[model samples]
Target: MACYTKVEKETCIACGTCGAIAPEVFEYDDSGFSQSVLDNNKGVQAVPEEVAEDVEEAYEGCPSGSIKLNDTPFKPKTPVSS
Candidate 1:
């Protein structure tokens, strides 16, 4: 199954806990805030199966509880025919 991860920029404290635990998937931004290195650093991105464990560690290690994870792939709802 695919997994999605995101960081709450506003709530982030720049503590580096996530980065330290999951450097492969997380890193510090130019502003010194923790951010996911996936999706071109767009804040939210898919977690590779190999790094899913690290991503989970980052999520749990975040002191501010700013890390968010979605275990399922996003599927937009289809509009009903008129």
Candidate 2:
């Protein structure tokens, strides 16, 4: 299953825990807040298969509990035929 990572901007405290834990996936924004450095500047980033563990570690170590792993892909559902 594919997974993605995200940080709640409102809840983030800019502690840099996520960046420290996973610099490849996380970085401090211009405002000093932590954000995902993936998807061409979009805060949401896909978790690489190799770095899944690192992302998980960052999520666990985040002090503000803002980091998250979204395993479900977002897509509009089609109506079911009876």
Candidate 3:
């Protein structure tokens, strides 16, 4: 139920877009390497509501686009009876 699903650390390139987009959910290590602070069985760090818009923006802005999100499944609506 989340769009942001996987994060390719090797391809991340450490641009810091993720951290900038979601600081509360990301942080830079002392080694100057940016790392995600959140992770789960569903995915790594579901985007926060307050910064959802920003995260999407960053996702697009990512040079490598290493950040991946889950796509919601579509549901068909039932037809009304006449």
Candidate 4:
């Protein structure tokens, strides 16, 4: 099973919690906002199933609720809720 995560840059506070919690999956972009290490920008990435827990932790730790996770490999591209 493949897990995936995405950070909503528009809502992200650029606090770096996700990066700190899951460095393997999340990192700060040049703009100072959290982005998937794989995407390297405003996009999502498929995470290894073994790190799902850590990814969930990062999502839960996000104060701005910018981290989104999906159990399915292909998640719907939904708009960032204002």
In model 4, state the lDDT of residue 32: 83
Question: For residues 1-82, could you state the per-residue lDDT of candidate 1 as single tens digits?
Answer: 7788777788999988888888888877888777777864544457878988988888988889988788754343378999
TM-score for candidate 2, residues paired by index: 0.77
How much lDDT does each candidate structure score?
0.77, 0.76, 0.59, 0.77
Error of 4 at 52 (Å): 1.6
Candidate 2 total steric clashes = 0
- Which of candidates 1 and 2 is the stronger one according to lDDT? 1
Stretches of candidate 4 off by over 4 Å are 41-45, 74-82
Q: Give candidate 4's whole-model lDDT.
A: 0.77
- On TM-score, the stronger of 1 and 3 is 1
lDDT of 1: 0.77
For candidate 3, the 10 contiguous residues with the lowest summed lDDT are 68-77
Candidate 2 or 3, higher TM-score?
A: 2
Over 18-75, each residue of candidate 2 has an lDDT whose tens digit, in order, gives 8888888889788877877875234345677887888899998888898867786334
Candidates in order, TM-scores: namely 0.77, 0.77, 0.59, 0.76
What does candidate 3 score in Cα RMSD to the true structure? Answer: 10.8
Instruction: List candidate 1 segments past 4 Å from native.
Output: 41-44, 73-82
lDDT (C-alpha) at residue 8 in model 3: 56
- Number of clashing pairs, model 3? 5
